[model samples]
Target: MKEYPIMFTAEMVRAILDGRKTQTRRCGDRWAKVRPGDRMWVKETWCWCWKCARLNDPEWYHSHDEDDPSIQLDKCGVKYAADSNNAFETCDPMNPKTRKEEFKWQPSIFMPRWASRITLEVVGNRSERVHDISREDCIAEGCPSQDWYRVNGGPEKWFMVLWCNINGKKPGRSWADNPLVHAIEFKRVKP
Candidate 1:
């Protein structure tokens, strides 16, 4: 079975750990290879001073204890502790020679499946524009609709900014840009 290493922000990780998130959007090109039966291993970007840490200042980087693999594994395995397997580091990002420090800030592409604690079975998937995502799907993306869009505005409005940010596109990439996104629905599974 094909497997994917899916990255999640810490907030979304918490939501997923809480069993509230069920859907996610990925760039169409990136997700094109994901089949319905594939499995997704969730990787959480550490919560830390990303901006400062990116400058190579160790102080900022270590402030949150993000370097500890066990911590990340623990954070990722919050809900699925029984199924978590840290005995083997995934091969994708780690060869026996890969230093532990190098794994700390490697991009998601380098994250190996074995690093994940949460595994999801892809139940369904569809292609749609960022704006085409429904309010329900937005909630699945971890937005608390009532609080996030308290005004007359709704999830779609809020989703626009979020979509742009995640995609690293500037604003106005909204429905006007009509960026293609793959909406993937999944169920938590025993790893």
Candidate 2:
């Protein structure tokens, strides 16, 4: 007789059957949605919503189609909470030695409600700064936000500016700094 390892606890097994685990599935016009009683192949690295597990084909999981907009958004929303080892810490932009090291990190501040229409501007000595400025919009929502990560790269030699609409009528003041690599500038369009 061969012996197999039991990895899932009774509670976890129960949760899976009860549709409590993170997964995604196709529903009507949408590609990913939550559904109950969906069967999922549980693995140490298989992390997803309950719906995704049922709707996602095993072979398609590793393919680029997994990057579908709806799938990405749903996954983004669940990433921090679902990952068992997610953590973050504050860092000093001025001092590198004082920075906290962790596997997962994000900004402590919540994005303003007007964040949907925000724009980013970058002014640097190199072309890379332009790409960096565009990547700033990848900030993940909720805990473990990507704001800090967006601004943490490169040497401590450049300045950055971030502007947004504060009152929905006029452009808010720009936040200028040289914490990372090249100076960046962001300007909000007047509404």
Candidate 3:
């Protein structure tokens, strides 16, 4: 089967890890070609330890030495953003006293397959209008608790808010616009 890389926000990664997420919806036909048994490597925000990179691959490290030296490298390899909040931070090298917190975590889009810790196998796929999302699908898409839904005016409302937040900026992709989307269902698999 074919393998693909999928990006997830830290919150979605947490939901997947907690077994609360099993499906994802993408605007347009982005995931329409995905089929059952195809594998997807989840790419979340991550950061590599500079010290470890330099020690392991001196040549590669030397070639890209833009990493700040002040950033602490407690781990030996890549650290996923979903694993913890304590990520490396950069301090002012010139002024050691200046402690502006700049996270070292790279964007999920830039993550490489080798650094991924979660894999998913597509179990089902379908296409439907964004507004056609059901309450069950919302839960599968990692909707929060009942209490959260109550606060946010139920599951569909919550999903709409989230959808708008992520896709509203794109033309004809807003929740109100109700664009067609690909609904991809998946189950966690071995990395």
Candidate 4:
């Protein structure tokens, strides 16, 4: 099976972790090449412990070598934002901090393959107009059920709002525009 890295937002990561999300839809056929049995490693916000210890200095890597023996592998490992609220590191041998601190969470796009903690196996793929998404598909996309949207509208309305929020500003991608989308159905295969 082919392997690919798929980026996910913190919210989407949470949804997948919580067993609420099993599918994703792109504005176009960007994921068209993905087929059943393909593996997707989720890319989420994360930081290496050594980087976190350096006060999250963005350019810290330029000065230090990751393979340097001085860098403790145990203390300089990868930390995922979805798994913890904070990351702790022993920066000083003399005076170590007792509490954890929030990691300078990197963007999902910047996450490396080694930092990915979740893996998904593609089960299906299809193309359809964005407006054709059903309530079931909405749930698969991590939206609340129709009952949850009863106060405001239907599940479609809720999904429309979410889709617009993510794609409305892009040219020809708004819900009203009804752009064809590539829908990828997957199941979590690894933790």
- Pairs clashing within candidate 4: none
Residue-by-residue lDDT tens digits, candidate 4, 9-107: 777888898888999888655589899999999999887654334644547645666546454443545667777743454444333441245344688
By lDDT, rank the candidates, best first. Answer: 3, 4, 1, 2
Q: How much lDDT does candidate 3 score?
A: 0.77
Which digits, one per residue and each the tens of the lDDT, describe model 1 over residues 1-191?
Answer: 78887887656667777777888887748797788899988875422222212324556446655445544432322212222333223323233333333324344444455445679999898898776788788877767548658784787776666666666554534556777778999988964
Candidate 3 has a TM-score of 0.80
Model 1: weakest 10-residue lDDT segment is: 74-83
TM-score of 1: 0.61
TM-score of every prediction relative to native: 0.61, 0.20, 0.80, 0.77
List RMSD in Å for every model shown.
10.6, 22.3, 5.4, 4.6
Best by TM-score: 3
Q: What is the number of backbone collisions in each predicted candidate, taken in the order shown?
A: 0, 21, 0, 0
Question: Best candidate per lDDT, number?
Answer: 3
List residue ranges in candidate 3 displaced over 4 A. 55-75, 85-103
lDDT of 2: 0.26
Count: clashes, candidate 2 = 21
Regions more than 4 Å wrong, model 2: 1-57, 62-66, 73-119, 123-181, 188-191
